[model samples]
Target: MQRRRLLPLLLAAALPLLGGPVAHAQAGRPIKLVVPYPPGGPLDAIARILAEKVQPTLGTVIVENRPGAGGNLGADAVAKAAPDGHSIVMGAVATHAINPWLYAKLPYDPVRDFAPITLVARVPNVLVLNVETADKLQIRSVADLVSYARKNPGRLNYGSGGNGSAGHLAGEMFKAQAKVSLVHIPYAGAAPAQLGLLGGQVDLNFDNLAAAAANIRAGKLKALAVTTAQRSAAMPELPTLAESGLPGLVVDTWFGLFAPARTPAESVQQLNAAFTAALNAPDVRERLAKFLAEPAPTSPAQFGDFVKAELAKYEKVVKASGVKLD
Candidate 1:
């Protein structure tokens, strides 16, 4: 009887040592990193880049593309995935921040459904105009574009990746802050929008810096101004929108990693540390910088805070601009 009682007491004392499956300290499971955008987009490229770096650190990192509904599909899939650090989504400005306000109903709540890991990088939008239109419209800078748009009203139009995309919102923000009447033209994707701009089918394009920088340098598209708070290192010659005239007009399209809402805090920490390490790598920083992206490696808490602030900021932008997508 005493032995039985002592055995029970010993097991209770050893419970802490056992510590719930030993945390699996070395999980060989492959981590699925989902990208919400179509292949070859900025978010996709960023996700692929990080996956390449992170694979060595974390077992096998597989990238899965599930593009649709402005990135809501993949986000919803990740939100409902097993919260075992084995599945995560490469969430972007559209899926994590803007979609919350732009869509009438999102499949998942950006804040409630996600456990933010770290912000990988932030890519600023570049204001690009067709060379022919640039010359005909006399568009030289952001202020010049604003002045022309105010004078021309609906005659001037800009192309974006899609409705409720960062490009669309950036153009609208520009119109609102500059007090202009430029019509917004939404494209099915960024590539189509770029092609339209190049063919002179569209007057201007608020394009991703990486996608437009090469064309701008080739003189196929004339860069007007960068839409960030500071000049892009990739194109140091360009001016910021706020620097041109409108103050506080900073809008950068950012991408981060997130797991399911109920992911263990320790698992979240491990993933965050891995991503932060990858982002801090010198080669990784250089590669991202070439695309005018500022490398940002944040703690999980910091990333979560950033997401909340971004959601609020874009919500206000959507409401003020009255932007909505079905």
Candidate 2:
């Protein structure tokens, strides 16, 4: 009985010699959560927040920014990492879904190179029209937009972040499904594209709901509909595009965590638990809400299935749209 008590005491004393208390941490090494985007973005912010929250359970988590190649750089790095669950990435729809078809020679296969951890959140895209343009065009909803574009082919043009951006693809998908020929004007980035819309350079633009939420509320832009499977809580009054006479149109800027392929199943489960718990924390959700993100915690299997579906969806959309980087 004494030995049992002393054993723990001895181990505690020897902890310093074994390289401090962290030696007994949950992780053998500090976990690396790579953000496939530049610092100061929502992904990076969320990575930092989750890292801090999970450190108690995961031990010394670190957030790394490895932005480039439209998120392929960081995703590739994580894909090639050892499958120990210590190296993971905060990957977005572009890195895992769109980029595979956008860049012809992608270094890593989204499905084969990584084991999904958990889906962190999804920021929906909204089809918004500049207030002034909407009034002049007399369009109030998605049906009106489609009807106007159909009657006046090529008369309506839209702006997007770039040629293959989610906004661009959304516009293309709308055109294909709605059978309209609205012109597309690619801008340097979403900001510039939004600016163009504001300046009436383009009649409308599909944009990340979070990015456009402020303007929508302020009445600078008229949000016709969201591009998510369901309506967003941030704007419950707005309907989804699926409800707006287009069931085939569903798009969202989704992101999630992933580990290298072949990571131990136990490790994946632990990580999923830690992240899902962190995502459910009120503080974490509040922080995400500030960025207009909706926390969508999902099990590993669910995330994997969702990713596969997104891959198939984007493949169809990209091929049909014919937008490729390489």
Candidate 3:
């Protein structure tokens, strides 16, 4: 009788050990989804949505904002964190592609220090002008804007989130490709940059579609063109910058999930599956559309290759723009 009782106790104690990887991941610790930008921005909003959607499959997921150094601070933290898959960063174009070339002495290697899990989404930047300013300048399209800028010769100024941000790079690319001169103004974040545009402090802005969608809808801002090769599904009426006379002006920003380089493949795969499922959920897709973002989940290997291509593409852009940060 004692032996039977002890056997039951032993089996009960051993059950947790035999529960397998998924069970272990669930019971061990909560997963941390680190956002490298401040809260209330599109990145933070997306991260929070993902955390909520994937929590069912991921057990317990939480978002932590560690905004600084143009998203490098949070990315570096993940790169150096324990490779146990409990911690991951929501890596963006700024962190992985632009920062590598922009910063002279980056604390971490974008390709070497992290493992790409799955790309969350891709959002194009829109060339948005203040509604009142657009009306005043009669800038109805990219062509009109370019002509005006050429005629004004540095009279028109554009605002961006920061120096090396996607918006800034887009403005530089536009200046080069369109052969126009517009003074560049860098703000603390996209929100402030948009504020500058709305308040007439800046004439125009190159902002993420998701960040500017609401304002565009409300007529506070006029989106002249999307900085992508193709038009966005959420706003199909908007034309692409290429179609608007600048052929090679594509600046679509992407966000993805990344873990430490040494994180187990199994763990990475599990994470990819969970995030992919969450991204594909009908409700999640609807929410992403509200922000003008498109779901673009990819396998780990595919995502890795995509990141490489992005880095290579941005290398040329950064070099041509002559942008570097100390």
Candidate 4:
């Protein structure tokens, strides 16, 4: 009888350890980091770099690409995933902030469907012209472009990645603020858009600094102004659109990490800590600087608030521009 009583006591002691917060935290498959865009892009590059850095703290981190519908496919997959903290999406301003307003039907709700982890980085979009075109037109700055556009309306044309892309919106904002008409030509992606600019198929392009940095250094493209509220640290010598003449023309693209809503708060906290640490690492900072991207890590709560504000801001811009996608 004493032996039976001891066996029951041991069973009771082990039951609590099997099914609890600690157990849940310790038991899981390798975490997967999803990049909505194709591999080799800025988002993919950042995700891979972070995955390598965070593996020691978070276990195996896998970066997967599921590009389609301008990042909705991969984002939707993560939103519908089990809330076990094994999956996350490398979301951007396009997916979370602008897509809601631009698309008529979205598979996932940016705020309700996911938990914000941390804001990874912010990339400024630079207004650049083909070096040959800039010299031919004698356009040295934003002021010069505005003057020429005003003088020869509809003569200058600009290209963007797509209809609802940040580049497109930036071009529209420039037109609205500068009071000049520059024909907009939408291309498949930034690469093709940059090619269009290079081949003289388009007069100019509002491209992400990362995409244009190499070309600018190669003397293929001339940057006029950065589309940010302040000058970018990657290129501190470059002026911002606000300082260039348009005081309120700021268009920055940001990337962040997100988990499905209802994920355990403990897991969320762990992820936030890991990613924030990776982003602040000296080597990571150095890598991101090559693309002119600034590392901006924020708390989960802070990132949530920032997303809300961006959604609201983009809503107004999209509506005013009357740009929508199915």
**Overall lDDT per candidate, in order of appearance:** 0.84, 0.89, 0.89, 0.89
Q: Please provide the root mean square deviation of candidate 4 (C-alpha atoms, Å).
A: 3.5
Encode model 3's per-residue lDDT on 20-137: one tens digit a residue.
3455453568888899988987778989999898776777788999998989999999999999888999999989999999999999999999999999999988999988889988
TM-score of 2: 0.92
| Runs in model 3 lying further than 4 Å from the true structure | 1-21, 25-27
lDDT of 2 by residue, 1-326 (tens): 99999998887676444431154262357888899888988778888989999877668888999988999999999999999767999999999999999998999999999999899999989999989889988899999998988999999899999989999999999899889998899999899999999888898899998889988998999999999989998999999988999997888998999999999887788889889999999999999998889999999999999999999999999998888897
Q: In every candidate, how many clashes are there?
A: 0, 0, 0, 0
Model number with the top TM-score? 2
> After best superposition, candidate 4 residue 21: deviation in angstroms?
13
The residue-by-residue lDDT of candidate 1 on 1-326, one tens digit each, is 89988997876566434422233324436789999877976667778888888766576788999988878999999999999888899888878889889889888999999999999888888888999998987888877887888887899888988777788888888888899888788888789989988998889988888888788888899987888888888788888887889888888888899999999887787788778988899998877776678988899999999999888889988887687888
Measured over all alpha carbons after superposition, the RMSD of each candidate to the real structure, in angstroms, is 3.9, 4.5, 3.7, 3.5
Candidate 2: which stretches are off by over 4 Å?
1-28
| Segments of candidate 4 deviating more than 4 angstroms | 1-25
Question: Candidate 3, TM-score vs. the true structure?
Answer: 0.88
